[model samples]
Target: MSDAGDKVARIRELNDNFRKTFAGGMMMMTASVAALPEMVRSAAWLKVSEFDAWDTGNDPHHEHDFINFELCNRNFFWKCDYYAPDMNSGSEDPSDPEKTVRVGLLMLAEDY
Candidate 1:
C-alpha cells in the first residue's frame, strides 16, 4: 500500500475485477450455497455479480470487498480477502496485485 487514497483505489479496483469477472481470483461457495438447485444458484450468482450497492453502511472501507443481498427470499453474501501468492498468509500489501492472491466466498448470510 502507498498513500491512503491510492491504496484504497487500487484495492477497490482489484476487488471489483474479481467480483465482476471472477478473474484474477477464486470464489468458493459454502455447502449450503453449493447445495442449492442449479437455477437458484445461478440466479444468486447473477445477483452477486451485479451487486453495487456500496456506502458507509455496507462498504465502510470502500474497497468493494463485500456485500449482502436477498435472493429468492434468502439472504446471501459475497466477500473477498487478500492473501499472499502462496496462500500461506495475508498479503503484505493488498493493493499490490502482483504480490496478492484474492480469494472470495459466496454463501448464505446465515452462514456468515
Candidate 2:
C-alpha cells in the first residue's frame, strides 16, 4: 500500500477503536442507571439547566456547555461524558442513543 493508503487505514482503525470504547462506556452508564433507577431518576424540582450545570471540567468555558451521563447511588457517583474534538452533540440526541441502549440491553440479556 502507498503511504497515504496506510495512513488512511490507520485512521480508520483508530476511529473504530474509539467507537468501541465509547460504546462500552455508554453501555455501562445505561446499566448503572436502569439497575438503580431510584438513584439516577430524572430530577423533578431542579430545572434542566441545573442538571446540565453539574459538568465540572478544567476548562471554565466548557462547564456550562457540558452534559453528564451520571449514575449516582448512596455511595458512588459514576459519570461519563463523551469527549471528542468536536461538540458532543451526537450523544445528546436519542435516535443514535438507541445504539448505546442496544449494546446495554444485549449485555444485560446475556448476563441473565
Candidate 3:
C-alpha cells in the first residue's frame, strides 16, 4: 500500500483499539446514557466493545470513528473526535497518534 493508505490504516487501527479498550483515549457519555440503569449501561458498554458493523454506508471515510447501533429498541451512536495532544483544539495530523488525542462519545441518536 501507499504511505497515505498505511497512515489511514494505522489511524483506523488505533481508533478501533480505543473503542474496544477505552485505552489511550478518553470516553464521555451523554446525560441520557448516564441515566441508564447500571445493568443496562453495562450491556450497552459491552455492545460498544464488541461493535464491528462498519461498512461503506456508515464508514465512508474508513476511519472507524463513528458507530450507530440499537439497544433495547433505542438508537444510539458512538463517535470519536480527534484533538491535539494538548486537548485544546483539533489535531493537525489525525493519522499520528502522538499528535492526536481521541475523545469517544456515547450518546442517544437524538443527541447526535
Candidate 4:
C-alpha cells in the first residue's frame, strides 16, 4: 500500500476506537451520576460546539495535564477526561498509541 493509504487507514482506525470509547464513557457517566434521566438527556443533547478541549488555549488550568472535554446542560455540567496513549517515549514496550481511555465526572459550576 502507498504511504498515504497507510496514513488514511491509521486515521480511520483511530476514529473508530474513539467512537467506541466515547459512547461507553457516556453510558457509564450517566449511569453513575445522581440524576440518571437528566444526565442522559443532557448527554443526548450534547453538541460539538459545547466541547472544550483541555489542551487548547481556552483551558486556563495547566496544572491538570489531562486532555478533557466539557459538556453542560442548564446548571449541570461534566468533564470527560481522555487518556491518550503516549507514543513518543523511546521504550521497547511503549503504550498503544492508538488506544484512548476516558473517564467522565459530573460536577458543579464551582467545583473547579
CA shift of 6, model 2, Å: 38
Task: Write the residue-wise lDDT of candidate 2 on 2-22 in tens digits.
Answer: 765564454333323333343
Scored against the true structure, residue 71 in model 2 reaches a CA lDDT of: 28
Candidate 1 residues 13-90, lDDT tens each?
999988889899898899999999999999988888888889999999999998899888999998899999999999
lDDT of 3: 0.90
Per-model TM values vs. the true structure: 0.95, 0.23, 0.95, 0.32
Regions of candidate 2 where Cα sits further than 4 Å from its true position: 1-29, 38-40, 44-48, 52-59, 67-112
With a 3 Å backbone cut-off (N, CA, C), the pairs that clash in candidate 1 are none
> In order, what lDDT does every prediction score?
0.91, 0.32, 0.90, 0.41
Worst 10 residues of 1 by lDDT: 44-53
Per-residue CA lDDT of model 4 for 4-95, tens digit only, reads: 55654544343334433444233233433455467555563353213434353633433221223434443444444545444233323112
Model 4 off-target regions past 4 Å?
1-27, 30-33, 36-40, 43-58, 61-74, 82-99, 110-112
lDDT of 4 at 50: 39
Q: In model 1, which runs have C-alpha deviations exceeding 4 angstroms?
A: none
Over the stretch 8-112, how does candidate 3's per-residue lDDT look in tens digits?
Answer: 898899998999999988999999999988887788878888999899998998899998889988898989999999998999988888999999998989886
Between candidates 1 and 4, name the one with more favorable TM-score.
1
Instruction: Name every residue pair that clashes in candidate 4.
Output: none
- Report backbone clashes per prediction: 0, 0, 0, 0
